[model samples]
Target: MTAEILQKVASEGLPPTRMNARRLFGSFSFSHQPPYSRLPNELLSEIFLYATCRGVDDRHEIISTPIAVSQVSTRWRNVAISTGALWGTIIITFPISRGQISRALTWLKRSRSYPLSIFLDFRDPSWDWDLPESAHPFRWQDMEALIRLLIVHAHRWKQFELLTDTWAPIFTILHYSRRIKCAPILESISLSRCNAFFAARNATFAPAEMKVPIALFGGLLLDCLREVSLTGVHVDWTTSPLRNLTTLEFKYLATDVTPTKDQFADILEACPNLHSLTIIGRGPQADSPPSSSGSTATNRPDSRSKKSARHVELMSLTSFTFGFNDMDYALEILSMFSFPSIKTLALENLSNVDPPALQSLDATPLLKRLSFLDVSSDATTTPFPLSHIISLKLYSISASQATFSQFFDKLRNLEYLGLYNASKDVLEALKPSSNVDFNSSILPCATLKDLECRDMDPETLLKMVKLREAVSHLGHVSFEFSNLCPTLRTNFLDAGIDVVVQTTAQ
Candidate 1:
């Protein structure tokens, strides 16, 4: 009977309504041969929800989740269909086709009035955007049809993500979205064009660049938005200053479209509740912002110094990741904000700053009260005095001896230290600052209880761990997703140090 029910429902979909659920339940209630079959609909519905609730980013999982369970029996099908949130996350990965579009329509309809989380992934690294129209795998009209269908239900969108290589589809979706009065409940959005930087350089076909306006989806949706992640795409920061954002990231933005100095300050001022902020590829434009509303071309770094600095105090910001073109750009941005509660600070790329620039960072408040320090630098000069940091993660392909010596001198209170891609010279540079003598008995990393490295010399690592274990009782030493020799693995374990080596790298 179960097999027969699945065979029938494979091609048929049950309507999500209480009346439809009762009709299916009434039919199944007549049989009581199986004791488990008498389970109440409410209990069965909870089970159905638990089975289907997961990250629905992959579109193929639609068949594996609610759709697959709905075919188990008539009773199961009714329960699965009636759960509205089960169908809320709609993922579209494959190119548009009539059958796939029809399937998506069915999912949307079954979702009913539930808020939606949509993912549209059109990223193909191998396919050249310059390919002729005849060589394209998908028709433009079919893609537009899918976009239009999603736009029709714009008011229901709670989280929307689009990862593509070009801006054609993005413009199409936003053009039609002009009709939506406002997305009052929409909390987050992400638009990423992976090949945007390279695509913009082609003079043969420069896709006309357009700023993401606030009028999109009707009114000021930024009032409720909390998260936004963008790469190689930008909004009109000149006018659309975001507020109440908890997380914001901008990656790989071209020089022409980077945010202006004033615009960047506005974002910092407006979003006092920001938790995580990341900026890569030159950060915000250093020069003055454009005076005119039409021109955003002045969004570039100036050779001279900034005119002024505006100080801001954020009580909630804990994590900040900055990678810019120069040391000055990083310091310029850091000097403007005073984070009394920052816990994590990641500084990348500009670690090779000169003596003056490195010394200038000592005065900035960003280097104080840091709990975790993630720094990539090759400068011989010591950057800052961060004796309060309990953890530090260092990433450098060819770090200097002076760099390691200076870093260890300041981070005396580290309980956890992480190293990535540890080479021979880098590991050798991790020597004790003071030569061993009978008079002095200080050990390296005296307070360190945990150590982590992606790859390292096993003999050297065992020696370091053993030395620390003698003093602070080093509890755990982790080598994530890396191989460990059996001899040293046993030695580490024998020393009562927890050694973790994952076979598959994540």
Candidate 2:
């Protein structure tokens, strides 16, 4: 009967009566079924939550994962609706419209009483000032509405991030949302101006000046806040709580409001538990000395006086990054704070500074990972006290072979080395001499295991690899080149070295 019914249904469409088709299918005992069909509602809900969690950055998944899973079956729909955690995160990407705003509100509503993690990004390509005014797609009303909706549940916010090209809208939102004085659960806040347009154009753009200092939550303390990141935005630091911050980042801040040595010293004094610090752009000038209040004696060997007051010490700081156009300003800032626990250090645009400025870093003996970006050849002449560094990365830097050989020799315990846009002389210096015995010549980085180089001669690299292997077996080598020699690649592989070669397009 089932076969006859199936044949009739295939010859013609399903019977005009839906009941007859339903009855026919119900009579068949189908052994083939989807695996997920047998999963319990609890397990299915967990799977949906995992899928949403994994693709938080993907706009399509953020909007459709829960809805798609719910549509799979009636049971799934119920399960998804009941699982509030799946809808707790509301990520609103750029080019947002009324529809997206409405959907965002709906998702938040579905979250019920679950604590929220919200990421609102207004970095649309059309929003760039370089584009025509008519190209702008966002509406002030829509933005205000979305901000209002999120503010309504501000007390429940656990993580909030606002990224926009303009600071006006954010300031306006905060100004109007004065009632939101407490976010008891809020732990992290990141507010920054979008610089993607400038980055894409490879042009530097001046930061827009603000008429007033920014303040959040009516200048009240956020007891739960632990991490704060601000870029190109000035805030009233005196009123804000800085005592409990574990991670703090300030980048491209306006010169007028940038913290001076004393002000930054006060901040360091406030945050005794700070672990990571990143500073970029021009910091406060060192013309003014730090305050005498709570200042401690200098521990640096280069200190001029035994009783000279130094800036507050970051007792728990582990990582420090300095990137700025003025190397003098960076060095001056470094002289203010002493980080006894610093383990990782990154210096960008060091080429602008005198090599002696880096010598101030002798205090950080625990630094294990060191990175140099756009450092001048002369700066390499100054022997940095990075003997403890196991990993070194050099980018867009030119140095003589002798300088590189000497620098490499200092890193006796180095294991990983990365060279990008390296000069020919540097590569040649790294290559082992044919006549020199491996044990006799003090080769640079004798303990080196992994080497990464970009835009260098393949033959030179091959020789260096062979020489290094002769001394100490290199485990992995990666190269990015406009052209790669097959013979060289094969030779490295034949020697049991892991070789990765990527050809760059012209």
lDDT of 1 by residue, 259-310 (tens): 7767777877888899887775444665432222211112333312547655
Clashing pairs in 2: none
Model 1 scores a TM of 0.71
Candidate 1 ranges with C-alpha deviation above 4 Å: 1-36, 54-63, 96-99, 128-143, 196-219, 288-306, 348-418, 422-450, 455-462, 481-506
Tens digit of per-residue lDDT, candidate 2, span 440-490 = 346666677788777666677777777767776677888765555688777
Q: What TM-score does each of the candidates earn?
A: 0.71, 0.71
What is the Cα-based lDDT of residue 399 in candidate 1? Answer: 40
Name the weakest run of 10 consecutive residues (lDDT summed) in model 1: 360-369
